[model samples]
Target: MPAKRTALIALLAGALYLVVGVTATDSLLPAGARGGDTTTTARTDTGLVRGTRTATHTVYQGIPYAGPPKGAHRWAAPRPVRPWAGVRDATRPGPLCPQVASAYADVASLEEDCLVLNVTTGASAAARGHAPVLVWIHGDGAVGGGAYFDARRLADRGLVVVTVNYRLGVFGGFSYPGLEGSGTFALQDQQAALRWVRRNAAAFGGDPGNVTVAGSSFGAAAISGHLTSPGARGLFHRAVLASGEGMMDMPAGAMGEGVPAYPHYTWRTGQESRDTGVEMTSSLGCAGPDPRRALRCLRALPVKKVLEVPDIMNAFQAFAYGNEVLPELPEAALGQGRFLRVPLMSGATLDEHRLFVGMAHDAIGSPFTAGQYARALVTAFGRDAETVGARYPVTAFPSPALAWSTVVTDRMWARGTYAQATAFGRRTPTYAYEFADRDAPMYLPLPGAFDFGAYHAGDTPYVFEDPDAQKYFTDAQVRLSDTITDYWAQFARTGTPNRPGLVRWPRFEPGGAVPHTQSLGPDRIGPVDYAGEHRLDFWRRLAGQGTSPAPRPTEGKEQMS
Candidate 1:
């Protein structure tokens, strides 16, 4: 118990560093409410009462959906929070979940006790009737992200908006033999939040039955997981997966000692993976005199030291398949038609991997030369390296980096999105799109030396109104935001995303153009079949024969520092 408390303290301190750096209102309430800034108090099924105000239209801040996950509860399923006796002050933002990333921390105000959600609604909805609900789950590569996203603009468009903060980093995902009692605590947190909405959204002027779960990047991937998880079924009627897919697993299979993992053909038991996780922690410096004590010690360590450990950052290391919450891999389950048949909207950006590669290049001090770029592809492709390089030759591309980013992005995100639509569209309603807005502002602070292009995560601000990034958008971005908000609202109200004044987005049929897709940019909202043009034919060929091409690392292959 002491060990667990130590972990909690360490996590709290780390979260404090991130949250305290940016926000002035440290906790949920400010020292004093601004005079004349409209505020309304509402009660929930739980004991707690919260306050809402007109931040543009109507915004509800710091509403608790679950109890604080601290002490023994730290690694357990999220419990329902106790309601308050009177109107609780909620004019300030809540603490974000414990995480190491400073970017999300500064905005979310991270804390070990953080499990609150914010809501925004249109004034017209309160005057009229309950509005359709749009619950947004954030994406920060599954490590750090929360609902610091401002959704007032969308609420102003006649919809009820919700943004939630979930557990992140080790607090949310880490699983080991010593921690078997707490498997997939982060996912459990999400489930509890969704259930809370089902029971309590009506009080916030939202339709409990008409709910849409949407997200970008890791948030989108989480939506995919939620749509497939049994515990999450019926919580949300519709989903929007922006720049994320469930099929992009590292090595695409579960691994054990002496077992080489392969895509779609390997599976392992939870007990076995728990054993593997123990072994992993030991190698990653969790080797105290008492092995169990080591877990406690690691938890107590500084956040920077934890993130500095390279193994923790690896994608494959983050998500393991043994837990009851995620008993099976999303891709394998989807392949066997084991997912809930919910209507979905999924797609990618024009240059999804460009941002990642650009970060690598700037860190390494040089752009990837044509040959080195091909070599990197070969390195990733392994035995089938040569064939892969030939398929996406650097010479054929305008730049080696561009060619490499194109191939990686297609395989990791775009192709997988297409595959998800192709397979799921067979039995469910699906809408696919590619966010091609070149002028869309990169939401985070990008290095001036880096050229991330219209990369991954750029579409987030479009969904949530960002004050800083909005200034860069052309008039077209404004129109696209309205169109997207309307489409999303309509999807929540109905199973389909069809709305007036926009291009008619059709439902996915086998081998047919989905109408929901738009080539969003400076004034273009036309039918864009980029999936077809990219020769999904080539991608299919690679996947049908699971082998990576050989590496011919070119002169200036990029590398992360």
Candidate 2:
């Protein structure tokens, strides 16, 4: 790959890391709630587990929801945990799934026995019983785990919060020609965790039937898979997708040089995934004529050897469709309204691509020039390059980087998010939002003079309590955080975010007088012209005029970053 393309790939990978990867200042464990020493115990289906009780909430960590997926269980559907004979400690968190550390994130792990989950419920909610359940899935297809998020804040709002860890990278997503659970082991692990929730939520003071599945970035994309997966039906009553790629399509050169546009940015056909696996078999020293024997040899290899494969973990990041876990591509399923009829809330940040564009320039150690921006347009939009350039002139923005960021953010992220929100709104109650705190804190350790205005994953700290993040929040930002958490908890409780006192969020009516998309910011907290702000009309016209060529399949390596 060329230097530009390599830098772009690193930029994309760094974006993923910023979303869910652990920062140096991040705490691995949540702060203890007020008033300690009161122990609480919950009886899971397997056995009794003790937890720490505070005046505000009760937190249970490192609870096994499924049997360890090691040895013969590797690459197979998750199995039930063997019932324990005595009490199991639920204080510290379990190890994270296998993944290599990256330049942007500090997380690295090689543990395969990592199928664990954490539960937190408000003390008042536990006493009341039947509190609505919020099941959280952490972001990044290859990095991070459940314990990264602190659920104590959300739990305090009369909700039972459950954060889960599943397989990651090659350990969870690798597939072979004869693999029984080709391309879907991680997804299957998530389903198994949901099954565990269904059986044991009552013990944790949650209503099994009133469950809301929520995630951001890759985790949100996985929820999109579950929306259409037969195995996930009735497992969740509501869904929240923040910065999900359910309807995203990558433009040529948007990710890297020579990388063609993909209709489904986060999905792959089972055959394609299997072919990639076959290509890797030789690299793994397990080449053979028989598929079954090759798979056996591949499985017998140590986890370190699998991790050692170049780009192996990122190769399997895109979930394989046309398999049992996902019978069809999630983007296609979502477009045709073939998903379950559930209440939905979906949105993205105002400057989603700024993080990627800024990081790309930062990695290359040069400013994004106006000439480079023009070339990028031609590379991405093809015949519509001049038209796009004319619409978004360099003089219209503060810098070339912001201009390019706005272009991709509108054409790719905003367009996809708008389409998904309208699709869900047409079928079920939907709430759309735009995180518009332009001055949101720069939590990542990125050293640059770029203006990262409410960039990708910037809204994360508002939902999950991070002590490092909280220290940087201004008074207004702190209020915004409380309001956002309330909205989430209220939505999980009642199917809708509307309640007394806070700004009334209306349903997203595509044909209404104005499709209401709550603009979440410290200064402004009401509906904003989402489509107009993102210049979606120009993108819509460009689409109508046939700008780019038809989508083509790119190598899995190109899809990851």
What would the TM-scores of all predictions be? 0.82, 0.93
Candidate 1 global lDDT: 0.62
Question: What TM-score, to 2 decimals, does candidate 2 have?
Answer: 0.93
lDDT of 1 by residue, 263-369 (tens): 42212345554554455455556675575676666566644555554334222213445456666777777655567767778777887777656545542366667
lDDT assessment of candidate 2: 0.82
Question: In candidate 1, where is summed lDDT lowest over 10 consecutive residues?
Answer: 552-561
lDDT of each: 0.62, 0.82
Alpha-carbon error at 146 in model 2, in Å?
0.4
| Root-mean-square deviation per candidate | 9.1, 5.6
Model 2: per-residue Cα lDDT at residue 109: 81
Rate residue 539 of model 2 by lDDT.
90
lDDT of 1 at 429: 74
For model 1, what is the alpha-carbon lDDT of residue 212?
84
